[model samples]
Target: MFDKIRDVILEYVELPKESITPDTRFLADMHMNSLDIMTMIGQLEDEYDITIETEDLNNIYTMQQLVDYIEERL
Candidate 1:
């Protein structure tokens, strides 16, 4: 699951595979904007059949955090 999410983000972002470490910050480290995040969230919702609240999205920062959030819905 994490790999899939990582792959999708990597497709649009320039970050390397090694940079996807658990501690990497999505916005600061990966340089993702809100649109990138929303798009990824949309893809995740479609793939997992779950809705992620906007408030919760803001709280997702690190790679581990995002994976945990997605896993909860999964």
Candidate 2:
């Protein structure tokens, strides 16, 4: 699941492989803004076939957080 989430994020951002570790901060470390996050959400929804809520998006900022959220849904 983690690998799949990473791949989905990569589809939108050109993040370095080393920078995508589980603890990497989506906004701080990855330099991602709100728009980047929304784009990422879209990719994730398409990949996972799940619609994500805006409120839920607000709570995920790290690779681990996103993985956990997706895992719960899966």
Candidate 3:
């Protein structure tokens, strides 16, 4: 699950793969704006065939958080 999430993040962002750690914050560490985040969420939804509730979006800040959320839903 981490590898899959990492792959999507690597494809979406310009950051080097090695730079992304579980602790990496989406905005602060990865340099992602709102649009980048939305796009990545969309891609994740498509990949998993699930919709991330709008309210849940607020809870996801770091790479670990996002991966954990998806893993829980799975």
Cα error of candidate 1 at position 14, Å:
1.1
Local distance difference test, each candidate? 0.86, 0.82, 0.87
lDDT of 3 by residue, 1-74 (tens): 87888898887688778888899999887888888788889999999988898789898899899988988888
What's each prediction's TM-score?
A: 0.91, 0.85, 0.90
For residues 1-74, what per-residue lDDT tens digits would candidate 2 score against the true structure?
Answer: 88877777776678776668999888888777788789878888888898889998778878998888888887
Q: Where does candidate 2 stray beyond 4 Å? A: none
Whole-model lDDT for model 3 versus the true structure?
Answer: 0.87
Give the per-residue lDDT of model 1 (tens digit) for 2-54. Answer: 78888888866987787788788988889988898889889888888999999
Instruction: Go through the candidates in order and give the clash count of each.
Output: 0, 0, 0
Error of 1 at 51 (Å): 0.7
- Candidate 3, residue 74: the lDDT equals 82
Q: Order of all candidates by lDDT, from best down to worst?
A: 3, 1, 2
The segments of candidate 3 whose C-alpha lies over 4 angstroms from its true place after superposition are none
